[model samples]
Target: MTKDSSPTQLTHFDQQGQAHMVDVAAKQDTHRTAIACGVIRMKAETLAIITEGTAKKGDVLGIARIAAIMAAKRTSDLIPLCHPLALTRVHVDFSITTETNTIQCQAQVETVGKTGVEMEALTAVQVGLLTIYDMCKAVDRGMVMSDIRVLEKHGGKSGDWVSLIDQQDHN
Candidate 1:
């Protein structure tokens, strides 16, 4: 309930009650990269249908990949207070684990900027997962979105981080 208690909330607003972008000008520009991931769990049969191009939607993985890339490019437009960044590269890949009947969506975003690209990486996951859900919903209505999280972030003064999930076997 207090500003000091919530660090995230404290840095998000300004004195006049108007939302403002955090001033990162003083911070040194560094090569930054963020890796984020999420899982879409569903029936094994449904996963097979998608992987085999049997779904009515057509090329589910391709569409999701494009959506993720586009989402990363448009992060600043979608999220207020985020700086527009020129990302050097954005890669979104899906690991279809047949054994688990889950699609692991991973988005890696890189940039040379004052601020980190964690939000961009996260936005890519959200939009990519949504696209997968949209394309496959006709076949599996019970699909669940879970395990959405940042797997790692590197560069900047914070140095490097590897998410807990990555430390554990994704199995």
Candidate 2:
């Protein structure tokens, strides 16, 4: 964004309000990374079943990890006006919070490209959490997936940005 640009400006739209993909042909390819997070809050028993590997669907985290990686690669197909990035790395991790009865999903995506991978990271986290929900829905359909957002992004023309919540989490 420039000095005259508003933060609310939708970059995906043209002046005529027609949707289009942002052109990155002029932008230099740089090593970029993004991290996104989401949490799926479920019943305690549901969490226990997943953590104890007793779910009928087999390994929850393993399946979710694979699903997240595939989602990252397919983000361009699912979302409009997104560049198909050649991501070099995609890592999906999960943490089970027994006390909170939640499963936290995080996806860190790295790519050497002209555009940012924030959308890819976000998509990965969401799909990963959704996979968990899908595999465990038989046990807990009421599971709530929330707080899905990009926690941080690095290596862009505008430099790096980190969410305040993520900064507070580090402290």
Candidate 3:
């Protein structure tokens, strides 16, 4: 294995590299929730078009919300490592901050499962943000996607972690 390989490579996969999914069956089924976020950066004018619901592609937030929810529910199908989970609930919130001229998409995924919901949450946000970029590309071809990350995670063996990005604002 290369020195730059991820720690996950050392822990999860075997030497045969058959790509087996991790078994969380022995782990306790705890209520888990993960909040993931991503940003869609575009021209100020393009944002105004989204804000005004004037985009020819239709309701930006509405489509993004549905996309995120659907992505969360289908996480197992999209990623091989993720376990199929009966998610208790999924919530996606969209906010546009004029200060940064960016659209922030946040996905909160909740479930009572042996494995965590971080991947589901992250996937939802990524797809949702990408959908936005696709929809608005005609107006802003240079749209940039950035800062796709988990903002918070809870109810797992590792306990909880809140992103330093969130903590920095509080201090």
Candidate 4:
């Protein structure tokens, strides 16, 4: 297989075009932070059960919050190419939107390491939503998760980036 030597080439591929983890050994250690967000929509009754803490599973959001933080720390284990990072902080937040019968999850992950924590943040958001689904599935199996994305990332050689959708919302 031929390799793309272009600067824009995918980092996970080597000169022989084989998939491998990027070598960050030469990279400088910087304080990196990433934020990710997603939303899960469910039936109004299910949302009510979650908000009112009436679910049979017990304290849905509280459990999911813990699950998200754990997911962030374990992200490298789940994704093959990801580096195991020593995270300095992981913060997860959930907001209920009664108008849309949805719950939004956001995660902020930080690490003083060579690579950014984008994957950790994204993983945390996804796992948080999954935990919510698992706890409430009996009442709302049709719950849908959507809009999982990295909202912003700071640090690294390439510098900072913010999703266009996120920028528009703030504007």
User: By lDDT, who's the top model here?
Assistant: 4
Q: What 10-residue stretch in candidate 1 is worst by lDDT? A: 1-10
Cα lDDT, model 4, residue 70:
98
Instruction: State, as a TM-score between 0 and 1, how close model 2 is to the true structure.
Output: 0.94
On residues 58-88, what C-alpha lDDT tens digit does candidate 1 reach at each position? Answer: 8999999999999999999999988999999
Candidate 2 residue-pair clash tally: 0
Choose the strongest candidate by TM-score: 4
Q: What lDDT does the true structure give each of the candidates?
A: 0.90, 0.92, 0.88, 0.94
Which pairs of residues clash in candidate 1, taking residues 3 or more apart in a chain or in different chains?
A: none
lDDT of 4: 0.94
- Comparison by lDDT, 2 against 3, better one: 2
lDDT tens digits, residue span 1-171, model 4: 123245566878776888998878878999999999999999999999999889999999999999999999999999999999999999999999999999999999999999999999999999999999999999999999999999999997778998998789889
Instruction: Report the lDDT tens digits of candidate 2 across residue range 1-171.
Output: 223446589877778888887777878999999999999999999999998999998999999999999999999999988899899999999998899999899999999989999999999999999999999999799999999999999996877999998789889
Please provide, for model 3 over 1-171, each residue's C-alpha lDDT reduced to its tens digit, 9 standing for 90 to 100. Answer: 332456366545656766667767667889999999999988999999999999999999899899999999999999977789999999999999998889999999999989889999999999999889889988899989999999999996778889998889789
Worst 10 residues of 2 by lDDT: 1-10
- Give the better candidate number (1 or 3) by lDDT: 1
Error of 4 at 23 (Å): 0.4
Q: Mark the 10 consecutive residues where model 4 has the least summed lDDT.
A: 1-10
Task: State TM-scores per candidate.
Answer: 0.88, 0.94, 0.89, 0.95
Question: Sort by lDDT, best first: what order?
Answer: 4, 2, 1, 3
Q: Between prediction 1 and prediction 2, which has the larger lDDT?
A: 2
